[model samples]
Target: MPSEVVVEKQKLKNPPLDLRYLGDRALRQPAKRVAKVDQELRLLAKEMLQTMYTADGIGLAAPQVAVQKQVIVIDCEPDNPANPPLILVNPVIKQLSSQLCVMQEGCLSIPGVYLDVVRPQVAEISYKDENGRPRTLKANELLARCIQHEIDHLNGVLFVDRVENKIALNAELSKHGFSAKAVKPIA
Candidate 1:
């Protein structure tokens, strides 16, 4: 089947999952397989992009759609310029630098939740493109942070897990309509 057809079928058969806005358990479940880029995944990707755009987000993950798949769509295009959208399938971070950068991060799953999470300032990632071709990306700034944050969802990690200061996170969480206890770091 054509990728577009498959994505469309999936959209009809399986609706996108509503993100869980509270609780750590929902945020920790690993995503399932993305069999292929059928019509369903493609439609889901479009809807996700719409959602992200509506919410003023830079990136989104499949798990946020309530789908257990290693897929992420990103458009860090500031001012909604001429840049094309990015669709990553089964993405993996190949390299993480020791240089730490702290930036305020948020999640679609954990709605309104924002916290300063310290992570590598840059990352090298490999994944399948929209056409099922392998591709690699070296990212920085908001793009880098957004990718790392979304990829973490694919691995059952949340921004709160990487938060360096609890008090600041708690404050931010309140503003975002989230509970601070909704996330806890793995030991």
Candidate 2:
């Protein structure tokens, strides 16, 4: 059996998983590391990838789907069918670059809102593949940022929390009909 399953680029008859929004309690809770990579877990990853593609998102965390598991699916190039998505289980950040870059980031949970968030330029992460095989990846630029953002979701952290410019943050949130209070800023 293949270690990973690539969800075909086809819309399912049913709607995607209901994503937990910023103010939702489920989004605040930290996700638990997956204990076993069974058939069920693999199925969840497949479904997550499908949900992400359907929502036009590059990355998604298990908590976003109210799963409470440390699973994340990322696909930087969704338009290219040849490029497969990644399924990370029990991911751990091993190294981070000292350099920081600021980029506009958006989340499916907080739709219609975008904010500039600063993050490390590079990251090395160790994780398990969909087959539960150990794997490590060194990511840079957009991929690094995406992985960090999704990892934050596993830790109950939102990209809004990393937004330093409160004025811009509040404006975007307000414009998107989201409450500014929903953001829990980090020091």
Q: Relative to the unseen true structure, what is the Cα RMSD of model 1?
A: 4.7
> RMSD in angstroms, all models?
4.7, 1.2
lDDT of 1 by residue, 20-126 (tens): 55574655788765668665666777777666666566778877766777889888773545566778888889998889888878776666666777789898999
Query: Model-by-model lDDT, in order?
Result: 0.73, 0.92
Alpha carbon deviation, residue 70, candidate 2 (Å):
0.3
In order of appearance, the predictions have TM-scores of 0.82, 0.96
**Pairs that collide, model 2:** none
Candidate 2 error regions (>4 Å): none
Report the poorest 10 consecutive residues by lDDT, candidate 1.
Answer: 5-14
